[model samples]
Target: MSQISRGLENVFIKTTALTYIDGDNGILRYGGFDIDDLVEHTSFEEVIHLMLYGDLPTKVQLQRLKTSLNEAYEIPQQVIDTIYSLPRESDAIGMMETAFSALSSIYGEMWNKNTNKETAIKLIAKASTVTANVLRAKEGKKPVIPESSDSFARSFLSASFARTPTNDEVKAMDAALILYADHEVPASTTAALVTSSTLSDMYSCVVAALAALKGPLHGGAAEEAFKQFLEIGEPERTEEWFKKKILEEKSRLMGFGHRVYKTYDPRAKIFKRYAQKLSERSNEARKYFEIALKVEELGIEKFAEKHIYPNTDFFSGVVFYSLGFPVYMFTSLFALSRTLGWTAHVIEYVEDQHRLIRPRALYIGPLKREVIPIELRG
Candidate 1:
């Protein structure tokens, strides 16, 4: 029998031209455009347009996309109604899961309709609204509506915090969203594609993907990594804390490595910059950023020889925290950013002559035998 690639590591199931990652060189591309190029030149909405369409938009097209996003920013009435019924302190993730699952009724008979531009737009725009609102509700605040077509990054932050974000904060948020927009074929995107292969509604497909992202081994890493910094308590204490946990305690540090990239995560490089800038946003932010930097330097010095370097989650938690999101809401931000990728892949898989994404599993068990009588003697 052939070898089983446990967890399908290094396995190729389908071909996608959506996004590309060269782990060895630490490169990422979305729709064949270099990620860094997109970050420098494009807005988050522009990046979404690039992912949904095959090219950058003209002025008219970009404006239409922005207008559509502004229009779609409103959460459907039913989803909001459901949110209002939940306890103010309810889980942000659960709120998102339940709210998205309610989409089948919003579009009514979505399984028959393959993913299109509107489907993509609604998910991308509403994800920001829904994620921000859930956090607001948890904070015992009213849901803030997004009003502008131009600056979603600013809109989301202002709405969620009930205060306008400074220019630096908006730029940081935009960069963070762009950095996280997509990553070729991740576990969650694959799960979404698998669901889409069955011709399931986009709602069900995205929810399945979100469930995969919720795993602590995946999307939950950022939240845990942030908490680790808090636990370490102070920047000067980072080395001692790391030693106590890694040497004496023999524990796993949350944010230092990734499965795909041996080199430092490219996103981490960008986020670390934002984290540094955001650290200056407030005194508390500065302290956390210092701790994050200390942990990174110590971790790389210790583990880089083994190709275990900082991954995206390493600084993402600090960046998000500096932006005023709660630790628990970290993954919600991840999910919102990643839904663009998921929505894109769903469209590509459904349109590209996809197949059911099941693979054969090896079974190692005793051969079938006849059942013994009720009381078989030993």
Candidate 2:
């Protein structure tokens, strides 16, 4: 019998140059650049270039990529009509998947060495537009036209909220997008790579990724983690609630632990700062931040021996909530940021190897037996 690796744990299917993770040290990097350095020095647009094209872009190259992205930001009118026609109560990420799948009508093509890169750029560029419009349609609001003059972050924010964002808000949004642009190969990335392995178009690959990301264990964790803060209500009640819901009842704490990182998620560290800074602007945000701090304090104290620390989802919801996004839209925002990573991985995998990802299962059921007659089976 073959050894069974449930969930394909610790499986290394192939090598990737996109993102690197040192789980033991809680270090993350993109295209050989340290995550901390990238977040501090580079905008989301620059990170997009780095992930797709390899090295950091020069001033001229960055400008050109930005131009290409801005040009592709406007999704087709048919896609917009599809977005408007969906039920208002539809899941945001589900709507995003549908929108990307709809892109197949126009952009879908068989694997082509010449045109694949251009298709990747278009998918990444339009992800934000698709996400923002999905949110608008959910609220029965018309789509906001993309402005080529606006930066990537500004473009999404202005359209989503129907208002121009302040410079500080734009900076925060950009950093958040940069942090989530890529992370080695999580489940969603794996799903995407699997689809791309079969030589599917980039849009179809992203749709597969989105389907995987819509699950609670993956992309929905941020929304669930933030709900814990809301449930705790007051900062002073955190201890009692932690004792009742976590310690005594043994309920799982959503954002406290990670599968890979033994220490604090480096992305979470960056998000904590943004959460703190943005929390100052809103009374509601300040209250949630306070509760989150208390929960983290207690969580670390209890789980330090286990090496289960906060992951990226810990404070990300707080930052989004602070920015006035609804709780349900959390994962959709994640999808928006992660589209770059998904497409980057898809392009790399398809262009490099293009092998189908099929693994054998260890069957443990009883050996084949003769089927009994229907009357005798009972």
Reference-based TM-score of each model: 0.94, 0.97
Backbone clashes in candidate 2 total 0
State each model's CA lDDT, in order. Answer: 0.83, 0.88
Best by lDDT: 2
- Model 2 agreement with the true structure over 2-93: per-residue lDDT tens digits: 48777777888778998899989989999888888998898898888888778888999888988998898888899999989899999899
lDDT of 2: 0.88
- As a whole number from 0 to 100, the lDDT of residue 97 in candidate 1 is 84
lDDT of 2 at 267: 95
Q: Candidate 1 regions off by >4 Å?
A: 111-115, 373-378
Give each prediction's root-mean-square deviation over alpha carbons: 1.9, 1.4
Q: lDDT of candidate 1 vs native?
A: 0.83
lDDT of 2 at 302: 92
Backbone collisions counted per model = 0, 0
Give the Å error, residue 198, model 2: 1.0
